[model samples]
Target: MQFKPVVALVGRPNVGKSTLFNRLTRSRNALVADYSGLTRDRHYGEGRVGTYPFLVIDTGGFEPVVKSGILKEMARQTEQAIAESDVVIFLVDARAGVNAHDHEIATMLRRAGPKIILAVNKAEGMNKVQATAEFHELGLGEPVPISSAHGDGVADLIENALASLVNPVVESSEETSMTEMDEEALEQALATEEGEEVSQELFTDHRIKLAIVGRPNVGKSTLINTLIGEQRVIAFDMPGTTRDAIEIEFEQGDKKYTIIDTAGLRKRGKVFESIEKFSVIKTLQAIEACNVVVLVLDAQSEISEQDAHIAGFILESGRALVVAINKWDGLDQDKRDWIIREFERKMRFLSFAKIHYISALKGQGVKALLKSVNEAHAAAFRKLATPKLTRELRAAVEQQPPPRKGIFRPKMRYAHQGGQNPPLVIIHGNALDAINDSYKRYLESRFRKVFKLEGTPMRIEFKSSTNPYKDSEK
Candidate 1:
């Protein structure tokens, strides 16, 4: 799986960690409450700052004097979060000032040695800002004052925290060396790997892998039919009709693509049949294998839990996601707008995905959908030249300087394009772990806007000066 950077919010009870998490993630996935210890389990959500996306983890709050089993479990979960996180947000309540519990948490965070950002929550008005000075006594550096409820300073706090974790010198090139093989040779190799009789003629020179995924009966099959202009895959109103993934080859604008139609996925307990069990696993495997995923959603149905589950899988797998709202023929403009807005709001984690409204049965937006697919495919393989990347890096740094964690100012030495096919770029820098998410997002957004990687998911590999070995060398 692709490794997205992970940030964990750690603090004592009732310090608005969950509130901040919801704000950063732009989702209500985490349960927020006034009561302490309500969040007993760890919650994971996708967080985005500009175009740079990362996983945001919300752990149960810490309580120093508690000895109950539940509190002990919460502590264990917090410790695990610290260990797994790439950066830690040491949140404190500015309204409450620096208390004994805040001091204790700061000590533990220092011991953990992860990149730390002290966030002072509930600092809203001028008086609260003055009170925020008290948090300086915690000794975790100048606190970023924020109000989780009113959405003030949270963005700046997150931007500052994440900016410290990015490495600007990473190379931006496809690590996979292009093997100059003829169509016959490439097909033969792939067939041999699969241990099956596959057609060499089916493989094309510039083939793109696109997987159709969604809840059952979202017209995935219908959309595929519209794309290929053939009823290659069966389309029916019956749910779970597609029991296995079927790959079809087609050419679009001189480029070839393998379109995969997968079985409709349901919740685990709802999926009982053996065929369905196998189909779910196969669909997940296809998602991992494909370069881009077209998530089909029913325009008529409200965005269901199953849709979110499928989207989550695609995002977590680190594949480029495109949303196709099928069966948009009868809907009015207002309805379409409402659906689009609500869908975007609910699946905010999939904000990276481009949305298309289509009437698969009527062929209304099929052409535009295909064009988007082509653009997304091309974007997926985009690579940046070293000079251009370095220029952009310099510009980004000059615009907004990296956050200083101590006396040392982290310097990004160099960057190079390492690979494509989901473009990978690596940077060499000082204290690479301290490069925060905001700066990383700024750099990524700048890179995407300049390079015009409109619909692809690109990864930035942050490497310190000590680790210079490329995968090719290994």
Candidate 2:
């Protein structure tokens, strides 16, 4: 697999690093405010300039002198980002001038040994030479004056940054050229009935991006370390130990997986610190980026509303889910029964997901958890034949036709596969706009049963047709 070059944006507090991040990636994923230290985690985003695509890392304030508390952790994350990046964009505030902290960061970057691009931000209306004059003392290189917020000289900055890549951006053709036989097979697939064999060549193996997420200190890091057979991430006993979203690539048997260990999420009301609030945002972004989610829950404690909230967000995101109740070992039968009942009562909506009890500390049920992850991934991307889908839809309507709303009963129609990753079934017919929620759920259940779409969310969209002649007659 070809990997994009990573560009790390390093700077002190309130130096417009996040602003430059949003400007480069063309996304506001990194929360930007006037306050300092708003970004405490390494937030990742993808940016493409025409055919050139690369990954960008937005880091927290780089106070290299701060040796204690969250500042030190943020400094560590910036260093890691710097190490992984092919080029580093050291941002300095043009208004603030070259400060002691900037000099300190520059000294460290000199020894770090990545292609460094010194960018002078907030230089919108100032003279380019006068704006970049004092930054020469940092000794990194000639400073590139640009305003992150005003979009001045930003594209040139990115082009220069990507030019330093060891492996230049070679655009891969996305168009899949199919042979005549493959085309015929695809045509037959649309007409094939349920349980019939389709072309094996239609499917191909690729890496699965899985994310392990949950509340703070719920053994998420422990589970990741146990899965990779190493203490890769910090698995400390303290809460909020893992602050950044760390991606690790490893293979189990023949399957390749890139597992992301993300920061813990706290309820909004309980999140008092601004850093934790930003951590929550990064966690949510991680959930959005992955193909499957492994929600790690604490088996020792009662199921909290926060856990359900996280699972609900997963469902709303339409990603495949696998629930892992961690620390299942050493629990009494009574406690286990109580936990099961609590889960059933609270997480009844997540019945489509596969659940497992595992002890990450003891390596018990780990294999089964991975098996469920694989199964969920496959189900999420599974293809459904249109003829089979339509047949199943007809059978569902026959068993229990939709009830009449006033004088118009919703006419039944054929269904076809519209998308994957949360298989979308589009039903085309008249009066579909009047279908009730209960009937929609019923159809969903029927489709889920016939298609065996377990461990993944399924969606049904109704597209109503209009009668052209009725308008003229009226």
Candidate 3:
């Protein structure tokens, strides 16, 4: 893997660090709102200037003098980000001028080793003299005036940031040469194989992107730390410790996977906090982006409506799912059975997903859980042959034919795969519009059973054949 220089965005609460992050990364991945401390965790994103790629770390607000509580934790996270960064873009509010918190943060950054660039944000209309006047007192260096929201002076800011890096980005020609060498090596290997096909597997990104999601304090971050075997993400003992969807890439056995540690999702009615609302949106997006989702459920607590809602969203999105009953080590056999029963009663609709009892803290049943995840990923992308699909459709119809709807029975003819990743089987027939949801579900079950499509939700689509003669007569 090539090294991408890390750029850490550091500043006080509501100083436009996230806006600058979004500007540099060209993504709204970091939640942006008109509030102090909307971002709590360090969110990493990839940014590029021309052909040079660099990693941007969007950190929480820096309160260096904070002693206790979440602010202190956020300060620690920001400090860690600074330590890991190649360049630190210490952002300041041009509109707000230099405050006590800004001085405190600047004092801390001056002692740090990274290349610090003091940026005066929200300076779109201000001249260089006005923008630099207030910030010069901090004494980091010349202030780069920028408007993070309006994209003013951001390009120059990034260019200047990258230029200060120790290992400068390699030229495009050198990068191209390296890519050409890789392609040449691949071609030589394919030539040596002699009649064997190796094109599809070689060109594609085979990493399984798995999203681990659940309610607040359900060991989602704990599970991620256990899987990665490191404390890459802060697994603090708090309800909302994780507020960003942190993606960590790791390998298990021979398989490569990118596990997303998403923020806990609370019920919409209960989420009054603006930051939590943004966290909820980020969690949903993580589910949509990943190949499979590991829905972590609290083994001790009763299955709530919120859990079902999250599960329902996953099903609606048609993503492959695996239910992980977390913190199983703490629960006795009887309690475990009770929790399982409750889960079954509440989330019976998610019968297709594989369930596992695991202690994310102790690493119990983790291997089995990942195995199910791999199986689910495979099932989601599994190809269905048209002839086989048609045959299965005929067999299903023979076993249980559709009931008549006002003298018109559904005449199901054949089926073919319309799409994959929550595989869609489109059935062509007459009076197909009469086929109800129940019959459609029955067909889905049959196809699933025949194809062994476990850990994935399958859809059965009905396409009614139109009569050309009826149109002509009309």
Candidate 4:
């Protein structure tokens, strides 16, 4: 399959690379801030310039690292992104003018073998423009003066950049003729599994879409890497290492799964100060799309309010969940038990989910995790027969009668499993919303018990239905 072009953004610290990223992509996908080193890893987002679709990579701003450490790691990631890009948007702070570090980064970019576009950012007014003149000394080309914050001179830069691409654009009629041809090509590509011939469609028929979610630095990327047995997603020691929701598809023991590594969720109050707010939105989107969610938790840290909030989203979304206590290698037995018990008690709504202790760094417990995932996926799609469902409904009704408000007795007529894959059960009833929380919990408990659906989330929709003729006669 043909892939889109990649554009990498590189600049000195606090030079507005992130800001320029947000402007170019027309998305706040990258974290932007006033401080230096806010972005510590390479964040990828899709961008379209005119009709040219390209992948925009927002790299951490360069910090002149004299020695090997996290800063060196950050620089390496930036260099890697620049190396892979089709075009590099080399940003320079118009306000700061040309500095020693700017020169250093420009020298590196010149050797990277990508088409480099010089963007002099923070050029808000005349003084900024006058200051941008010093950037000519870097010797790449003419600096495209732009104010990423104010959205100035961006469109012209993109238009110019796309015009320089190597590919020739086909005419509209030619493109339309190629549509049927492309479908046949795509079908052929899908028939082969990465160069191996497959008789049946491995992933096309049945696939598990799972999202790995947790707070920052909870080893979400590491878990994905372990599951896929490769470095599909970049992992680092720093918090918020992952800034984009990256989807990768792979098969394990013949079961195909699509794993999405999401950005960590921070407290909404704290997010105002942190630049990773965009990442949080991406995580929420991932949660909404996935069939099952694997909530990764740092085994060392106490369960915080942010963790609970993230769990609440999964519960409300009504997706099958698996709580992965990551970093289990370092934890003592006592600590491990305490954390498991606490997580269970605090996240009572998610108590049905199975908890597994795993060390994504060491590749421990990943096999069992995958097995549980397969089971949960099957349970999510498990269909109950009408007779069986009615029996369970009777048991539930007998255990706890619907709430009585003074004189009236609430009645539930019938219930049926309407669908599978997050297994929705529709209950036809009278004054459904009036059913108390306690009775709702009882019904949920009874459903779980009858089905033995240990780690799957079940939905009970209360549909208040009555005879249409009776209402019309009234």
Give each model's whole-structure lDDT: 0.68, 0.76, 0.75, 0.69
Q: Pairs clashing in candidate 2?
A: none
Model 1: which ten-residue window has the lowest total lDDT? 195-204
**TM-scores of all predicted structures:** 0.52, 0.58, 0.54, 0.52
| Backbone clashes in model 3, listed as residue pairs | none
Error of 1 at 298 (Å): 1.2
Model 1 lDDT at residue 445? 81
The digit string of per-residue lDDT tens for model 3 on 1-474 reads: 123566889999999988888777776543222234423566766574434556678888888998988898788767766765668999999889999999998888878767899999999888879877978999898998989899888878888778644355554341122111233543454345332232112213478988888877789878887887833433232233222235667876567787765554443222334345334345555776788999999998989876876787689779999999998886678998899889989999999999999999899998899889988988887777555676678788999999889998999766666777888777777898998888888888888888878999988777777777996894
Model 3 vs. true fold: TM: 0.54
lDDT of 1 at 425: 68
The whole-model C-alpha lDDT of candidate 2 against the native structure comes to: 0.76
RMSD for each of the candidates: 16.6, 9.6, 13.1, 14.1
Give the range where candidate 2 is weakest over 10 consecutive residues by summed lDDT: 172-181
Report how far off residue 96 is in candidate 2 (Å). 30
The TM-score between candidate 4 and the true structure equals: 0.52
361-409: candidate 4 lDDT, tens digit per residue: 9988888887888777767766564445655786778877887876777
Which 10-residue span in candidate 3 carries the lowest summed lDDT? 174-183
